[model samples]
Target: MNNMRISPAVISKLCCLPAFYFFMFCSLAAYGDDSALNIELKLLQVLNLDAENDQQKMLGISSIRFLPSADPSKGNLILLSDDTGAVENAYGIFETPHTFDVAIECNNHVDGEVCQYEENYTRDDLHYPPLFTEAGLNQDQIDSNNLWCSMFYVGSFFIDSSPVCESDIEGIELLSGGQERLVMEEQVVGFTFSTPAVLHLDAQNFVTHKYTFPFSIFGFKRNWSNQNTQKTGVRPNGGFEGIALLPGEEGLYAAVTEFPLMQDAHLNRFVLFSLEESGNRMEDKVMIREHYSYNVDKVLPEGAAVVKPGYPKTGVSDILAVHNKRRSFITIERTAIRYINRSISSVNKLFLINLPDSSDQFSSSELPTMSVIKKEIPIDSDVMNNYNIEGLTWGPELAGGNKTLIMVNDNDAGRASQLTKIFIFEVVNL
Candidate 1:
């Protein structure tokens, strides 16, 4: 039943290591934990993956996590991909070990056999016939027409793309030939893990279960788009941005929305969903156990000279649960801007919030927002010149009370040659 694959080296190590050593091995692999209790991250080093300046359309890796490695210097990094829309029915997958290639792979060019990189991006696949007539699309049509669900985009026939999406009689499109296709706004919403996991430089141990959330969140407030409906939810490009698995609870996860929902403009909404495996992947429903709102600090950063300054540009990027501690996490808040041709960020900061267990769903109750009261931890722009820091996670442990912390820049904006930067920090005072 556990049909996952791993390298022989890992198999050898796991086979010979004592039972407690198994836990030790797992300890070496950070479970994205840190209580965020009075901890400080000291700058150690910065590595530019695009030193050759080659990454192009494929360079935007929104989030990242490190594969387990004994040698911290040589581990392969797992970079999550372009943040948008639902993909497929994948579940009961990661257990023994799963291998995935991460980041930009340059098939187009190379130097001395080591592939140089270029990422090709396109958004022309939004038209689908199956979505129009309850026709049910083929796998290719389903995959090609990545379903978009943010408030800004809506579909003609609705289909399974959005909760607000229902059959619109007049909205169907009849092509010149006999065929018909559905018309939808080109811009898609929702976030799914995209690509690049180096199998050679990696040891595999990842998510034990696949996760799925409400399609409504993607195309929230889509009733405005629907011929006759108005269900307000997510903002444009602001669907589920982060996922943190609860420590003690099975299948329980904290799903973080990037910005405030249309109804909850004052704070960011965090919804808790419980996933249960079933015979049908499509039938794999997420139970909304509870939700909460976190009051965000929109105040701009205090620096000598800020690069990009936009009030509406601020939002939460990612969240990570502290190890061994339930309901504890550190959230990444970013205030970004466009400087010249590059998409630079003026602010990068972290706030610690310990969420409580068992809360009323945000929409159902009139509850006060939970403010992040911990002292602000700002990753100095001077020290970290490369901006747009979207992802952060605990790395391999270090000597003494100090631990290794790794943060990755999205290279979210700018041209193809934008440098992909990964920051290393010495986390002290744990």
Candidate 2:
């Protein structure tokens, strides 16, 4: 429960009048389905409260994906706090999250603050328990295929002290009976990312250690400063949304969302690193010196609309980047899917970039780019109405080896909107 408090001003920028509310209504509708991994987005759940204990009403869910240390079918669901503040430092303020490990035993089982919506509930009274329901999907519906996957949360949170150091206090605890443990807590160790990114891994089947980074070593680095680092260093133009451990390689790779909040004029970037197990703990993960960056404005110049990045590009920010096994480094843009050709045996590096305009909005038109593929997946207009597309993960493969794309939207915790419309798309060869 690393609660990072945000400023009221920043919170204002993230809020939309009717756009946000529309998305919230659509999101709850998408999650209400009981079965069928339908491409059509439906509300999975909803939260409504207006009383003293409202904070406990709905443990806002952020991202959902399979964890390595558990059954392939069951994954871990993470939620962020509703308080308006920076996400990285929010854990320091309100440290409790309503988290649930998606398991067979917990299927559709309602308990605690999450019961059917009562007419007495309203947002005015600042109620306690929120209302929620299990994902409309069931085991049989999603059991048609066998595959491995994991997802990480990467977003901006106005932070104060240090997220690493303060995560261990009793305040921060996983809500689902502590399924997601507090692996490491530390102060800012050194800013490894221009954008905030979380490392997620699928330990093949089940994993023992769910926490992947060196939180302890980082926490001990007392000199690290969150404010100074963000101002001076490379703050991600697009937030770090996509994360994946490249097979045959050492560490992990992630996609950075769009630049400068929604419009970055610099280079589109992606980070690479290796995760090494140190004496029974996760630590010493080094970032690849040679990273990958592309120009987006140069590619899609057809009046690129205001939108966040998506899977390998989405998350809270825009860019969610990841590699498809031995293929290429896939970078999701606001309008297209761009890939850099790199053989598995080749030294880990970006392959090409022949461009001119270097501004954050500079698209790649004249250069001999690697490979840019446009996506055919139809977006849920309701979810993308206010915030940009946020969550993106290479979904589980089907029974016939065809690949599917699993995407989610950022509810900004429960502050902005809530839509459990996890998009499912089958990749068709272009």
Candidate 3:
């Protein structure tokens, strides 16, 4: 049994904070100092969901993917956020600021209707650069890549508000922006096909045009009202989390953090769902569950830091590894990172489970397999106790390619969170 004890001071510390209430309304953002930290290993940016401004309180980051362009820096970084719940639902381009502008998804001030767009946006006067650069592209290419093909996908979480419910695909281009051109028309096919409510958009575009079945797949499904739902819904919950889009498929496999700070539960989960060709309702979504045990006294008598031989090992000193060599999907639970004192730190031990043939345990039809490539993370400290692990990306498979694994944490939008760190590692023979 886990001890659910908390000192009165810790309780008071949480109750007195207004940000805690704000978290109920918005997802927690990744809080870190603006001053660059010298991350000697792989680095991942934390999206502070509670951020009050683009430069501050980094709110939930909707997407993070590499833009395979000739110039890596110019248009290589693609990042977006709803921007503090302002302008109904607004999206802005990161990596470049001069050409950035906001796209409205809904007008909250409107009366009687919910989650409906009082207006829309376009690229003709796109009002922003690197904004919808692919606008006016071949419809066939858009369909093949599962790109939104429009300036933006807008609609409500409620079903009856629009003709095409759950409409969220917004296209982008160098096209300019204007109200007459945008709000004047709506995608009739979108509204006609699904409920105006419950539509969602992708956070980042995959390098390729479609989905691929790389391994045994597991997806998440939940009440549309849940936070995870909101994050992936027409609106989103925020973070630089990972989602894989495979070849020739419209479905997305998204990995989400299942635990939060101060929570006693240790079980973490991820979900998978498919979007229609029209980018509407998730067609056959599923849930993937993984339970991690951190009972230090019982499981690690020699301490979690002591590794058993024959497990994956590396000469990388200054990092922790014990039974780190294993094959399975990996998730970092911040709640599992523990602190022994200000100077000494202890982290939750990482665990693994074999993949089952059927995904029947999940709510959806897709089942993930054990055939995954496990890369030991470069968490220098025992990654057993902290609660903010929020980022994950697979390394390149071939030699001379990037075989790096990285993870970052959410600081819970507080000064205490400024200590959040990103850890990097490489995969070798296990």
Candidate 4:
């Protein structure tokens, strides 16, 4: 202490060094401990089985919606299966290097001697279920009718015989329009009938309506009536392939894909409908209407559907709408191949489309200018070839103005795998 003294500037400079070191250590700690920064994508959950033992398969998950839960940190996830049923067992249970077969038989004819024949059909061959039909039938009859109707239309088994061992009249009554009448005529002799075998005469029971079938034989006539109702709005004639919850409205938007398999050629657009909430329960209102049209072919990747010609080249596979800081909506378009195995080999595309204010109308013109977010994203992987990306929604918010996006794959196609994967991605600047 030989009268040595430091100036204020020197003292200040010396104080800054430790502060800098402290900040550096803190930053390093955050960088090391924070999981959101290191990886762009993370696997959250894998839902393989539902309550009924139906394993999630290829294109199994068509839509996803996030419902507000009591805990702000968590949300109830509602998943819509593209089609509810077992994955089409194309190959035998013991077959290796599993492959899809339109029709497979266990035994073959050897030297003109008939052997045991075990036939296996793919889901594609036995189309899932029609999106629209008369209701009121029990679940068993509904399923039988769905199978017979699919067989009648897809397999060209237009005869009156039921593919399933059930009453043909039960399935015939479920059909709509002339098909119902045509099928019923085969069962009813000496009777001339009109379309709409089951006619909705009244609208008192909005949830469930009454359908009447009029018949006459030998100057005797009577009105046969049946009750039919829809659970969630009018069952979409087209498959419910995509859904987006309205940010600040009492409704959600849904999309019906334009593939030939759905058999709904007229519905190639998005629909906006309100949801009726009763305490903890929610049901769709019967007031859904067209919202917008997003053509899939406009952004179809080249050579995408070459492997599966039957699959639609372009269709809206999934949709997610969120509001930007400007109070305008931005939609994420997830387009994918429609086939099961082919979708694995094909690449899916995602686009960002800006929407007008929620009060304003949506136009197809906005689609042409939509910006591409990620192009050429493969639905399949080296480990899993039948993974088809379908469901997408906004996940929990992340730090640094970044948002998280969650997507799920439908894995029930070529292989009978029970694993359905959920992927999380961090959305950075545009």
Where does candidate 3 stray beyond 4 Å?
A: 1-242, 245-272, 277-328, 336-354, 359-387, 395-402, 414-421
Clashing pairs counted in every model: 19, 89, 78, 4
For model 2, how many clashes? 89
True-structure lDDT of candidate 1: 0.43
TM-score of each: 0.57, 0.40, 0.34, 0.41
Error of 3 at 222 (Å): 12
- For 378-399, candidate 1 gives per-residue lDDT tens digits of 3333444337676776665543
lDDT (Cα, tens digit) per residue for candidate 4, span 59-148:
344444443234323343434332322222323221101111111111133453211211231222122233235244455654554442
Ranking by TM-score: 1, 4, 2, 3
| Position 211, candidate 1: lDDT | 29
C-alpha lDDT values of all predictions: 0.43, 0.29, 0.25, 0.31
lDDT of 1 at 312: 33
Comparing 2 and 3 by TM-score, which wins? 2
Candidate 2 lDDT, tens digit per residue, 1-430? 3323444344324332233333211111112223111122222223322224544333333333333224322233332222322232212344322232332111223663111323332221101111112144244422321101112211122133222111110011221223432211111112232223232222221123323332221122122245443232223222333343444444433333344222223454443444344463333343432233444432221223343343123222222223332423333333333233311110000111111212232222221232222121122333333332333444433334444444444443445444333444444330
Model 1, runs deviating above 4 Å: 1-36, 51-58, 70-74, 83-212, 215-231, 301-312, 338-345, 357-382, 413-417
| Model 2: residue 394 alpha-carbon error in angstroms | 3.7
